[model samples]
Target: MPWWSWILIWVALVALSLLLYVFLGIRLFRQFMATLKDLGAAGKKMGHISPLEQAQTRPEAGRPLPGSAVFASPTVMRHDYEASKSSRREQRRLKRVQRKTDRGQPQALGDLDFT
Candidate 1:
């Protein structure tokens, strides 16, 4: 090959590489801008919601509200957990007693709430 042909080949290769980089950079810039817009929208949506509301909403949907937990004391969280657990247990016990009574079965003395 002639030396000038080699120079032409080198110039073509450089030009193609530059074009490729420009294309990739534009794509990357567009993606970054899109991400930033989404993040801003999300921040705006979440900014108005109080931590307590986040806690209530997350638990109902079966998702953990880690954000609320961060603001609350561990003791408070444990107390809430225990309180809900005990109330559920009491409710189940009451239902069982009611079912037994309806079926004419003798209920356990422990389950009988005289109070």
Candidate 2:
């Protein structure tokens, strides 16, 4: 092939590369915006569920909220308070269990706790 032919091929390759770059850049920008919109929607959903609403439905299922019915004086709703307390106690128990497991279950030293 002539030198001019090789130069023309090089020019075509460079143009193709630039076109691909621009196409990919625009595609990625649109994808990023879509992801951000989804994240915003997720945040809005979380915000829609206030502590009061959560407590009214299933207080025991979530972390206790400050000044919730669970913690009110005399505990008008004993079941709610008990449920919250049980959840908290279960969390603490799970933490202790995890600690024991992570610590490799203590070695038995003459009747010491084996786990």
What number of clashing residue pairs does each candidate have, in the order they appear?
0, 0
Which lDDT tens digits does candidate 1 get at residues 1-115? 8889999999999999999999999999999999999999999998998877665663556434667777989998898789889999999999999999899999999999999
Stretches of candidate 2 off by over 4 Å are: 50-115
Cα shift from native, residue 106, model 2 (Å): 43
TM-scores for the candidates: 0.56, 0.43
* CA lDDT scores, all candidates in order: 0.89, 0.77
Could you tell me the C-alpha RMSD of candidate 2 in Å? 11.4
- Worst 10-residue stretch by lDDT in candidate 2? 106-115
What lDDT would candidate 2 get against the real structure? 0.77
